[model samples]
Target: MANESVTLRQIARKVGVSVGTVSRALAGENGVSDRRAHAIQDLAKQMGYRPQPLRRQRAGAIAVLVGTSESGHPDEDWSQRLIVLATRASAELSWHVHLEFVSRNDDSRRAVAVPTVVRENRVDGVLLAGDPHSSIIEYLHRHEIPMAMVGGRAEKTGCVCVNPDREQAVRTAIHRLFELGHRCFGVVLSDRRYPSTEAFYQNCRQSLADHGIELSPRQVLENLQPNLGGGVIAARRYLAAGEPLPTAMLFTNDWMALGAMMTLLEAGFRVPRDVSIIGQDNLPWCNQMEPALCSMDNREERMVREALVWLRRRIEGSPCEPHDVTVHSELVWRGSCGPAPRGSAPNGAGPNGAGVTSPAPAKSRQADPSSISLASPPGAS
Candidate 1:
C-alpha cells in the first residue's frame, strides 16, 4: 500500500512530464532538461512521494582517458584527436577535466592503475576516449563511477557507449563494393580486442560471404603498429605473399588505408583499377590522397560532444536512462574506389605486368585540432 500510495505517473502528470522523467530526476540520473528536472523533483517532494534515498555526489571534474602505447603515443591518430576534442569540449562547457594516458596493457597488467582522481572518487564521472583496458572499465564500475565512452564499444560495461554504426558501416561498404562488382577482398586490421574494430572486421567478412566472396586468410594483414609505418608494412606483406591480389581492400581505419594505398601505388598497383580501397574514420586527409581515399564517415566529433553532454547530465541529475546509440555513416565515394577491373570478379593477379618494379609518389595530412568538422555524411538509399 505504501508503494502505491502515490505513483510516478501521478507525479509526472502533475509536473507535465513522462513517468520516465520523474524516475530519472528522483534517482538523480541523466536525461531530463535542467529546469524540468528541478520542477519534477520539487513536485515529487511536495506531493509527499517517498522515493529511495540517493547517495550520488558530484566532484565537479571529469576524467578523460586516451588508450595509448606504453611509450605514450596513442594507438591511432583518432585516439589523440579524442583527447584534443575532449579538452576543448570541457573548456567550452567550463567543466574541470583530468586527462590521463593509459598503456594498452591496462586490462591485464598489475603495474598500470586507474588515475588517483578516479580511484578516490574525486571526479563526477569518467569519459573514455577509445578502448581502454577492460580492467580500467572494471575499476570504474567497482567505484560506481558514471561513465560515457566516445568511440570504442565497451559492451556490458554498464556505461553509455556511443559511436557511428560499425556493423552498418561495413554492410554499407560491402553494398557499395558489390554494386561496383567487387568480389575477392583483402583487409588491413588492428587487433580485434577493440570492440568497435572487431565489429567492423567481423561484419565485413560476413557481408562479403553473403555475396559469395570468401575473404582469404593470406589477404588479411593484421597491423601490429596502427600508424603509417604499420600500414606500409601491411601493404608490402600483401604484395610479397604469393596469393593473387583481390580487386578491393578494406581497412579498419584511415591510417592503414593511407599507408597501404600509397604503397600500392608505388608498387605499380593502380587503386580501384588494380585494387580498390575503403577505410573507416572519414578523416580529412582522405581528401588529400593522390586519388582521394574512399572512407566511411564515423562522426567522431558528434560522439565526443554527445558524451560530454551525457556526463554533465548524469552529474547534474537529468531523467533519462542511458542507452547505447549508433549514428549512421555514409560511404563517401572517391577516386580511390572504383569498379573491379574487367575480368577480376572472383579475384585477380599480381603487378599487372612482369617488368614493373620500382617506387612512386605518395600523399596525406590530419585534421587541425581547432576545428570540429566531422559531420554525418548523408546516408545513401
Candidate 2:
C-alpha cells in the first residue's frame, strides 16, 4: 500500500485523520503536531510525493518611476494603465510590480537617486511614465538594470521605448485645421524642457511649411504653464491688443485648451463661431466640456500594454529587441474649426496685431520690419 499511489484521503485513512489534518501535517508549515508532521512526511516519502517548485511561488516585482513633480497634476492615467497591465501580465508569469515616483526638482540629484534603487534591488525593472528622464536612463544603464520609457525617446542601450509619433501627430492636427480653412494659427504651450514640446513646435513648423506658411516666434505664444491659466494669459494679451485675434488656436495640451475656451467666452467670442481651437492629449475633459474639445487621439492603453510586455521579456533574460515605437494620433474634428472668415488673407497673411496688410511668401518679406505677417491662418477676416 505504501509503495502504491497514495492520495491525501488514503493517507488520512492510514493516519486515522481527516484529509485537512493530513494536508496540514504533510505541509510541515508549522502549527502542526510534531508526531503528525513526522508521520505525514514519512508517508509522503514512501508514496513518492514531492513539493512544488519554489520558482512558482516567487512572483517578481517591477518598479514604475515618474519624472514629473508629484504636486503637479500627475497624469497617472497613462502610467496607471501601464502598471495595471504589467501587474496582470506578471501574475501570469508569477511576477509583480512596484511603483515609484521620482521628482525632477534638481537634475543633479536625479542621477544619484536612481542607481541606489537598482543596487538595492527594490524593483526588478523600471518604467518611465512620460517623457524621457535622461539622467535615470544613464544611471540604470550604469547598473545594468532593465528599463522602459513611454512617450519619449530612450538613449541608453537595451532600453525599450514606446511613444507616439509626435511629428506625425502634430502634422495631422495642423493638416486637419488647414483643411477646415484655418489660415491664422495660434499655439499655446509650456516653455518647458520636455522633448514633446520641441517635437510639437518642429512638427507645427514643418506642417505649415509644407503648406507654404511661415510662423514667427511672436505669433506662437509660449507660456510656462500649459494649463487654463496659461491659455487665459495668452488670450488676454491677444484680445486686449484689440487687434484681429487668431481665428484658430492650437494648444500643446488639453489643459491649456480649457483656458483658451474660458478666455474666448469671456471676450465675447463663441467657440467655432468667432474662433476655432484645438489641442493635444485628448484627455477626459475633451468630452466632458460643454462644447467638447477638438484634439489629437491616442491609444494610451495599447502603448502601456506593449511597454510592459517588452519590459517583462527583458527582465526574464529573454532575447528582446529594443524597439522605438511611435503611436500616431488622429485629429478628432469637433465643432472647433471652420472656413476662413470672409476677406481673410491666405496662408501667408499679415501679422495679427502689427496692423500692416501684406501678402505673398513670408520668407521674402520676413526681413522687412514694416510688413507684419501673421503666420497664423485666421478663418475670418
Candidate 3:
C-alpha cells in the first residue's frame, strides 16, 4: 500500500500551484478559479493528502459537451454565446469559466472516459448546460459528482435541473396564432432527434390538438437539418407534395424559419398573407427580416443566471432550493404572423409551379440582415 503521510507542501508542488493557493482552494475559499480549485483538490486526495477542516472549493464552470465537426455543429454560435455569458457572469462572481468539447465518440471504447476536469476532481460541483449523452450522465453519477443541468433533464441522482417550459411555449404560440385567426397549422422540425426538439414537437402537436386544430402527419416536416439549408429543403419538399399548405407554419428554430421564408418568397408566396410563419429561439435575424419573424423565446438567458446562482449555493455549502427549477418560455410577437388568409394555395399552385404569379409582397422577407444570430441558451456570476 502507498504511504498515507502526504503533506500539503507535496500536494502543492505536485499541482504546480503555490501553497497558499492550495490552502485557500482546499479550505473552500472563493478567490481561486473553480477549475483550478477542483484540479488541486483532486490531486491532493490522490496523493493521500487531506485538507484542513475538510473543506472543498468550487468556483469553476466547465462546458462539457459532445462536439461534432463545425459543419455538423449548427448551434456553434449558441454554444459560443453561452460561453461569453458564462465568462461575463463568472467575472462578476469572481469565478472562472472552463470549457472543453468532448468528441461524440471519444469515450465509446472506454468504460468511462471522464472529462479531464472531472477526472482531476477540480470543481466541487459541475453545471451541465444540457443533457450531454448517457455516458456523460453515468460517469457523473458513478463518481457521485454534484451537478446542475440547465435546459436539460437531470440524470438519475445527485443532480438538479433547470429546464425550459416547452409545453408553455407551445401553448403560448398556439394561443397567439388562434387569436390571430390562424386555423390551419403546420410544423417543421430539426431532422435530428434532440431532447429539446422532441419536447417541442410533442408539445406543439399536443397544443394544436388542445385548440381543436388537426396537425396532419404530412403537415409536419422533420427530415432536414435544423439549420437554414434544412428549411430550404423543407419548403421544396412541401411544394412537391401538391397539398394545400397550412395558413401558419411553425419552425423549430429561426434558421429553418428564415430558410423556408426565403424559399416560399422565391416561389411567389406572400409571408403572413399567404402563410404566417413563426419559429423558436427568437434569434437576432428575427429583426432583420422585412417583416420580422415572430418567435417563442426559450428564456435561456434567465435559466443560465439561475443555474449559476444554484451552483454558487451548492459549492459554497449554502442553502439551496429544491432539486428542480423551471424557466418558462415567452413568445415575442412580430410581423411573421397575421390574420389567416381567406383562401390558401397549394405549394404547387405558386407562380414557380405554373400557377398565376402572386402580387408583389407587401413586405418581402428578401432583405438580408447585415448581421443575424439564432439566439438560445445561457448562465452565472
Candidate 4:
C-alpha cells in the first residue's frame, strides 16, 4: 500500500474516519484538531496516498491591490512589510499575488484599472493592503469581488479584515505607562486624510479615557502623515508648548517613535526619566535604537498568512464562516521606561533580586517618582 496509489475514500475507510474529515485534514481546516489532522496526514503519507491535482480555477490567484503609491509615503514601513508578507503567503497557497500598484500620479486611472482587473478574472480574489479610499472599496463591494482588507476593519463593506486590535494595544500601552507612574499623557496621531487611517487616531482617544488618563486637547497632536518626519515635527511642537510635558508620549507607530526619540534626545531629555515614550508596530529597528524602543509587536506576517487562509476558504466556496480575526499585540519592554518616581506603586510591587518584581498584569506600572522623571538634565545619558 505504501507504493500504491490510493483514493482519499480508501484512506478514510482504512483510517475509520469520514471522507470529509480526511479532506479537511489534508487541506488544514480550522475545526480539525491538530492531533487528528496530523495523524491523518501521517497515515496518508505512510499509505502513499497522494492527492490528485485539481484544475486551477480563476479564483486560485489572489491579487493584492494597494491603494497608495510607494513614492507617496516613503517612510511608512508597514505598507512594504504587508506587501512582502502577502507575496510570500500567495506562494504558500500555490497562487500568484498580482500587485496592482495604482500610481498616485495617474489619478484618473485609479477607479478604472481596479474594476477592470476584477471583471477580467485576472485573479480569484483581492487583498487590499494599504489605505483603501472610499471609492476603491465601493467599487470592490459593487463588483462582488471576493476580497479582504489587510489593514483595519473595512468601514464601507463587510469584507473580511485582519488587524491587530488597536484599541487593546493602546490601552495596554497606557496601562503600562500608568504603572510606571505616568500621570500626564500625550498622544501623537496620524492625520485623517483617508477613512481607514482614522482607526489609530480615534482608538487612542478612547483608550486614554478608558485607562483614566485625561489628556488636554492641546496635548494631542495630529501629524499630517504617518511617518518619521511627522513624528519629529509633532514631538518638537509638543515639547515646545511649555505646558507640563506628559510623563510619557505615545506614538502611533514604530517609525514615528524612532523619530520622536531623536527629537527628545536632541532636546536633552533622558527617556523614562524626563519623558517615557511608547510606540506601536514593533518593527525590526525598534530594538536597534540605543535605549531600544518600548513598542507593541503587531505580528504582521502571521496576520497576512491568516488573511490568505480566510480568502482562500471563501474563494473555494467552502462553508467557511465569515469572521474578523484580530491579532493580539504584546508590549516589548526596553530601557526606554524607568521605575516610577519613588512611592508610586500602590500595591507595593514584589521584590526580585534582579529588579522590582512587578506583577506582569495585563499592564505594569511603577509609582515611585524619584525613580522616574519627565526630563533628563541636558548632556546626561
Tens digits of per-residue lDDT, candidate 4, 267-354, equal 6555666667888788776665656678878788888987887888777776554456787777788767665544332332222111
- Per-model RMSD to reference: 13.7, 16.0, 10.2, 16.9
lDDT of 3 by residue, 35-130 (tens): 887798678667766323222554354433433333135254456666666667667877655565543323343222346566566656666653
TM-score of 4: 0.67
- Mark the regions of model 3 whose C-alpha exceeds 4 Å error after superposition: 1-75, 104-112, 155-158, 318-322, 344-381
Better of 1 and 3 by lDDT: 1
| C-alpha lDDT of residue 199 in model 3 | 78
Q: Of models 3 and 4, which has the larger lDDT? A: 3
- Arrange candidates by TM-score, highest first: which order? 1, 3, 2, 4
lDDT of 1 by residue, 254-337 (tens): 888778877776766677666788887888777765577889888877878888888777667675465787777778878788
Better of 1 and 4 by TM-score: 1
Query: On a 0 to 1 TM-score scale, where does candidate 1 land against the true structure?
Result: 0.71
Q: Cα RMSD for candidate 1? A: 13.7
Under the 3 Å rule for N, CA and C atoms, how many clashes does model 2 have? Answer: 18
Q: Order of all candidates by lDDT, from best down to worst? A: 1, 3, 4, 2
